[model samples]
Structure formats: C-alpha cells, structure tokens
Target: MNLADVPKEKLSPMMQQYAATKEKYSDCILFFRLGDFYEMFFEDAILVSRELELTLTGKECGLDERAPMCGVPYHSVDLYLKKLVDRGYKIAICEQMTDPALSKGLVERDVIRIVTPGTLIESSMLDDNANNYICSLYYGTDGSCALCFADLSTGEMSLAVPQGTTDLTVRIMDMLSRYTPAELVLNAQALSLKSVMDFVKVRLQCAVTLRDDACFSLDTGRELICQQFGVDSLELLGIEEDGAGACAVCGMLDYIRETQKRNIARFISIDVVDSAETMGLDLNARRNLELTETIRGKERKGSMLWLLDDARTAMGKRLLKTWMEQPLVQPLKIMARLDAVEAFYKKSVSLMEVRALLDNVYDLERLMTRGLFQKASRKPHRVT
Candidate 1:
C-alpha cells in the first residue's frame, strides 16, 4: 500500500502518520516508535501479537472500529525482534525523528533501521559458531546466473558464477544448501524461473526479497560494487570480467539498503571463490556422506565433522565446518594443509600448549561484529 491507499479521511493526526509509514513499509512488520514503547497497529499488530504471543489489545483510531495494537518496551525491543526474525520476519524500526519536548504537536518519527534474519549483528541474535550469510542471486537472459554472499557478523563477502551446465538448477540449489543464508534477494529474472523460485521457498526455506532487473545491469553493478569496495575497478576486487557476479553483489547491496535502513552490512573486503577451485557437493551427496549431520535423524552425532572436530573456539569450529564442506581440489593446497598437520603432530608438546592457550581464547570475530552493531545503533534513549 502507498500513502494514498491509506484511509486518510478516517484516521486522526497520529494514526494518519502511522498509516503513511505503514504504506511505505508494507512488506515489513513495522515497530513504530511511541513514547516508551515500540508499537504496532492495525494488521501488523494483529500478526505480531499472534506470532510473539503478546496481548492482542486495541487502540483508538478515528474510525468506528478500534485499531488493533500491541507493543513491547523500547528498551527490550531486541528481545521481541529476535523472536520475530527467528520466525522469518523483517522488522522496520521507526524512531521518533524529532524531540518530543520541543515539538509543537505530535513528535516526528522515521525508520532508523530495518532488521532481518540475514543482517542481524547483535550478539543475542546470532549463533556463536555459525556464519549468518545474506545472499543475492541474479539471473541473466543467457540462462546464466551469479550469486553473492555477505556475512554481516564476519564482514566476509564472496561472489561465484555457476558453471555453465544443463543441470543449472541443481548446482544453484546445492550452493544454496552449502551457504545456508538466512535471506536471499533475487532479481526479477531469477524470481521468474519457476524451478529456482520453488527451490528457494521450499528447499532452502529462506526469506525472499525481489529487486528490479535494471539494477542488475553490468555497468551499474560494477559502479556500485567498485564504489562500495573503494576500488577503481572490478579487477582489484577479483570480480569476473563479465558483470553477472557484480550484478549479484549490487543486488545484495540494494536489498541491504532497503531492509537495513540504518545499518548496512559492512564489507571490509571480498573473497571471490571460483567454482572449479573447490569440490562441490549436492544435497544428496552431502546427506549420503554425512559430512555435517547424519542422514536419518539429521543430527550431528554420527557425522564426519563430529568425529574429526576438536576445535577450541567458535571461530575454529566455523572454519572447520567450511573446510569440511569445501575441501581443496588442488593437490598443492591439500599438501600444504597436510604439512601443517604433520608439523603439529611432530611437536606434540607445542600442540598441547597451543591448545591449552586457545582454550581461554574468546570469539573475537563475533565480538567485533557485536561491537560494530553497537556503534552503528548507539544512541541515548531520549523521547525524540
């Protein structure tokens, strides 16, 4: 719904303002900043009240029927947000834009940030050892598609183009399962593909957001990516000469702009992984091999990782998972890994000492992510 679609004639001053704001963020569950509370009204209130198991209450609107209303304390908004996001919902945080004490009539309010499952950086909202990847896929007219991944918690971004093959959907679906992003943004072209669309919604069970096809243009993509990465050209970022990968990156960036109104996911640098460089595994293969989890019960008990993993820290655990999923195809890289293991084995005393020291180590990478979110959303809780 747009502003015009809102029932302007029926709503009073505050309700009218809310109606307009709701129109703007129709797709999101908006938490409108009211005094001491982040309130939801109308349909959003009804949905959230049921989802969060909050009291389904009512508020006065200028109409015959009372408006549905629900809220949580502003100070504890993150608690509610976590619940909603965990259930695959996006939250738009509307904040009072002006000082209530100084304002003449009603306080001016605007969206501060829009939070989603994929872009959440708060420590309370993320898993310690798991990567929270937000991905975007762009489908080109030539039956080729590019995918990009961004992890807000680690500031790791990557891009890969699916190898040109007849069974493209299988490859794409496998890649999706491998990364396991919380949210995905697809261009119009990608969303149009029935097979791709079904895989995203059914197989991956990820929240899908759409972008315009024009945004996926190669020139715009290169310009947007180069600007964001602070590079002169795509070559510096190791993006392919073709723009499909860049387009996917730009589409993801655009979705960040839309969903994360205030805090966009930070990207320090990108690591481009070529498809041929790593061993690729499909869903069936992963299930049969029991690489991460057992086949029947789908638990970690009898998995290969369960047998091999003895990592001390969350970072080590996450890295180990990645290494297991995509073992090196290159012989030299494999040998280098073996050499490191051999060195560790040869010096048993040093290995034991190192392990002991690592036992006390904290997950600094996740700490950095939480710190970044705190800095971005840091503000005094004033009625403004």
Candidate 2:
C-alpha cells in the first residue's frame, strides 16, 4: 500500500527502521529481518502473500490499525525467494547486521544482497546443465553496440562488440539467443531502441533492468576492468579503454556489485568474443532447427542435443550444450574437436574408464564459485 493509504499513526521504532530501509530498494520486495523470520511489510507483504499463497497477517506498529505482514522462516527462505525470482520479482534480503542481545535498543539491519533472475547462485535455484547468464548491453550514439554476458555462478565473463554489421539489432539478437540470459541490463540508449527492446521483452521474456547512463562511464569502466583482472591495461585483452565494450563490461560489474553488496564472485578474466568464430543462429533458425529442444513440447528428448549428449557429469553436459549452441566455424578449431573425438572413439576401453571416473565427479565449476561466496555452510540452526 502507498504511504497515503496507510492510517495516520506514529510507527514503532522497528517499523520506522523498516520504512527507511524499504525506501532505498523500492523496486525490490524487501525481506525485512525480524528475529527468526524474514518479515514482509505493507505492499511487499501483500504482493508476496498473494503470489506465494501465504496467509497475510498484521503486526502492531504502534497504531490501532495493524500493519499488513507476512513472513517466511529465515532458514527456509531460499524456497520462497526462488518462487518470487521465477516470477520476475527482485528480492532484497535484508539481514540483521547487529546482535540483538548486545544492542541498546532496536537491532540494526540492512540489505545484504538483492537477488534477481540472473544473480542466482544457490544449487537449488539453478539448472545443472545450463548457464544462468546476466547480460549487459550498451548502445552508443554512433549506432555501434557492445554486449557483455557473465555467468556469475561459474565466474565466466565474455564481451562482444558487434561491429561492421549493417543491422546491429540482428547481431545482438543472435548473441542473446546463444546465451539465453536469465536477466538483461540495458543502458538508456539501448533501452530506447524499440526493436531491441521488443526482442528482449517479447522474445526472450527474461527479467530486464535499466541502468543509469552514468554507470557506463568509460574512465570508471576502464579502471574497473583493470582492478577486476588485476591488469595494467585493456590493451593486452584487445579491448579499447574508451570503447563501448569497456562501458558494457563496466555496467555489468557495477550492477553485480550493487546487487551482491560484496565481492563474492571472482571474475578472473573477460574473454573477448569473436562472432565469426561461431556459426550464427538467430532465433528463427534455432527454433526451426530445434537445436536444443523440440518445437512441440520443448523437451530435449527429441532434439539434436538429446541424440549426441552422453555426458557423464553436469559440467560435461553444460560444455556439450555450449558447443552445440555455438558450432565452430574455423577449420582448425573444428579439426581439433574432431581429432579429440576420433582419439576417444579409437580408445573405446579408455573412454569407458574415463566415463566411469566422470560419474563420480561433481560440478566443480559451480562448487568452487559457490565456495568463494561462503554459501557452502551447513544447514542453518533452527531459530526457536
């Protein structure tokens, strides 16, 4: 409910604190920490309760009329967050920052992270064989555009600048189709492009975020790139310091930092993408060919991926899908892949042994990245 809709009564100190925190993240559904429960107040409570089918209640906020409230236990909040995120709602995980036992009055609390469709890291919320990419795009005034895609869970980031193209919208759509990003962030210029915006919203149907133009500052982006990779210059990476690529990459990093509220994921490098290296498959091409899923039920059982996929591990399956999505166009690379497959085919017994070994291997890429986030802890203690 809007502030005008609420009863005119003085709020309790704790409720007042919630109001102040909610103001900062007006777009997100704030999970305000209240002892053992992550409480939702006012509009957040109403929305979440209606969506999740939870019983909406009320709390005394120093007013005769109780404030609307709903809550999910902190230990089991991931389940609730996943439901909301799948429906394209952003969540602000406000945590109790200070100990209540030692506090003089009201315990301090703040948002530790803002979880969006693209920023998911929990194993339960992710698909084992699919990369959950968060894309960032910057469309310059010169009709040139830069695209950045990063899988936060795997710490893999790649930048693509679709230059020398008559229709950059087509190139950008091709890139988006390949990655199938869960979330997209666009600068003011990119968002203003009608065709691209339509493709993103109507076709992709993923969560879209609009970032301030200032966030794509060239100088700041250059510095962020250097600091992130611990490099002196973007020259070594073949990215122009003042180019749209740097701006796109910087916007992505800035958005991630804003949402995560900490340096958890380590982006070791930013790989420059060459579109020509891979076969271009636009949305129509992919859909008609049924490259990954069938056209009817959209299941993998009758698709190209199903026929060739014999991967034993989650990582192998994911890599195979990546290879399927972006078929190598360069002769040398194709030959190298063929040679590796030939070697495995000739050594049948060795291949069997390799598959047996892989059966026991976990998804190490996600495991290592999740470990860095310190999310690998044991089950949280049940709060009484």
Candidate 3:
C-alpha cells in the first residue's frame, strides 16, 4: 500500500516515527528494533515474509488500513539479515539509542547500521578464505574509469584508474571478476552510459546501488582519504590528486557513511596496491590455469592449488591464493620468495613437526579481527 495515501494524523506516535524513517531509506528494508525483535512493517513485511518464509501477520497502527508485519528475534537476526543481503537487498537496522526503562515517552531510537552485501564484519556472515569487498566506480567524462575496492573485513583498500581501450569491456569485467565485490556503487547519472551500464547490470549481476551524482566530488573525496589514512598528500598513497581513483574512493566513503552511520575504525588502515608490479590474470586465464580449481568442471579435487596447498591455517590458505593470483614480476622479490621456500624445503625433519603442530591451530587473523572490533575501536600499537 502507498503509505502517502494515509493521513499523517491517523498514524500512531510510534508509526509516525517509523514512516518518517522509512521515507529516508525507501530502497532498503527497515528492521525496526522492538523490545526483543527486529520488526518489519507494511510492504517490507510482506516481501521478507515470502522471501524468508516468516509468518505473515498484521498490526493495528490506528490508520484506515492495517499495517502488515513480520519479525525475527533480535538474537537470531544475523540469520535473517544474511538472507536479505544474499538476495541483494539492503537492510537498515533501527536501534534503541537509549535505556528504554529510563525513557518517559517512547524509547528513543535511530538506525545504527545499514547492512549491505559489502561492509559486513561479523564472522558468521562472511566466508573464512574469501575477501568481502565493497567497490565504487567513477565514470569520468574523459572515457576513463576509476575504481576503488575496500574490504572492511580485512582492512584492505586499493584503487585503480584506467582509460577505456579497444578491449575495455573485457578489461573492466576482468577487474570485477578478480576481486568479486559483494556490491558495486555508482552514480545514478551514469546509468545512461549504455555499454558500460549494461556490463554492470547484465554480465556482472551483482548488487548495484545508485546514489546522487552530486555526492561524488574530487575535493571532498580527497579530504575523506586524508582523514581516514591520516596522510597530507594523495600521491603518497599512489592516488592522483583530483583524479578518477580519488573520486571513486570518495564515492565509496559516501555510500559507506550513509549506511554505517558510525565510525569505520576497521577500515582506517588502507593499502595502495601497486598493480603494475603484479602479474594480472583474467577469469578465463584463471579457469584455464586451474590454479584453484580443476579445468574439467571446476572442482578443487584435481586443481594445482589442491595438490600444492598443504596449508594448515586460514591465513596460510589465503596467502597461497594470493601467490597463485599474482606471481612476483620483480626478480628481487621473486628470489626472496624462492629463498624462503628453499629454506623450508631443506628443513625436512622440522617441517613435518611444524605442519603437525599447525594442523590444530585456529584462524588467528579473523579471531584477532573480531576480538579487536568487538572489544575496542583503538588497535594495540606495535612495538618497534
């Protein structure tokens, strides 16, 4: 039902609050925090009920029409949130901002987090080995595009700016396939760019969010980068001043800020990737090489990685994948890696004992990440 058709005075006090908040995030499903449940109302209720197989119900909101409703317990909300996010839908979590017992009127609340396919940090919602990335694309007027990828789960951030070549579509698709972002954010105005837009919509088929074109700005973006990375110069981070990469990063922060509604201490640490020094591989090359999977039907059983991967821990497995994707182009770095491997090879007696010990080890990387995030925002400083 069109909520606008109902008179504002007809809504209950609580529902008036809901309607106001809903207007701002119309594209997303609002999970209003009740006492112990995350409630969805109106059309959002009907939609998620069918999608998540929740019981469809109704609530009397004092309006001419009864509001549709569905809900899940707050403790088990992650399961429901994952379902919507997996289906490419965004969810705004309206939280009680104050102690409900102390409040005289209705409990004061606001949306604390707007969860999207990207920007998820909870361990249960993410994969152990694969990185969860949220990327922003800036289509420049000069026929070039600047893309920024940020993995909040791992605190990894990188930017790439390249002009359209004869094989522009393939190159763009290759870059997308390489990282495999959970969501792609772009300017609403750029949807008119037929060829490029079609690739994002059809070929990629990932979640795409369109924001106002005015939200992306070179100066604002540079400031955001400087604030986040604590750098005075963009060039220091390998991002050009007033360039496409800069614009893309700015756009990314914009969407993140709008959704998260809080500080992103996890993403404060950033890395400027040197794409030139790494070997580049496309999707086709990855499949043909069978680096991580078999060529016959793409399973892990007969792959090169399957045979070579004797990794005992999650971090080791992730590092192995990195090695498979980007072999060192510099001879010095390559030699250093070879020397390390050679040392391991010669330690025949110690290597077997070490591997046996590591088989019982836990995933330290993700455990430390969750610990640091949940316990405190400030990370412990390293000793020099």
Among these predictions, the greatest lDDT belongs to 2
State residue 90's C-alpha deviation in candidate 1, in Å: 1.3
TM-score ranking from best candidate downward: 2, 1, 3
Candidate 1, TM-score vs. the true structure? Answer: 0.90
lDDT (10s digit) by residue, model 2, range 192-235:
67887899889899999999988888766787778888889988
Q: Give the Å error, residue 250, model 2.
A: 0.4
lDDT of each: 0.81, 0.87, 0.77
Clashing pairs for model 2 are none
TM-score of each: 0.90, 0.95, 0.89
RMSD of 3: 4.1
Candidate 3 local distance difference test against the native? 0.77
Candidate 1 lDDT over residue span 165-194, tens digit each = 648887788788789789998888786678
Cα displacement (angstroms), candidate 3, residue 209, comes to 1.1
Model 2 alpha-carbon drift over 4 Å, by segment: 4-9, 377-384
Q: Candidate 3's residue-wise lDDT over 1-384, tens digit each?
A: 656666768899998988898888888899999899999888899999999999989888987678899999998898998989999999999989878899899888798878999878776688665678888978777756777898776667777764444465565666776776889888764565676667667755679888777667865667777888888988888788877778888898888778877556556655655666676677678879888778788687788888887787766876787687666798989999999889889998888998888877766655565664572224432211
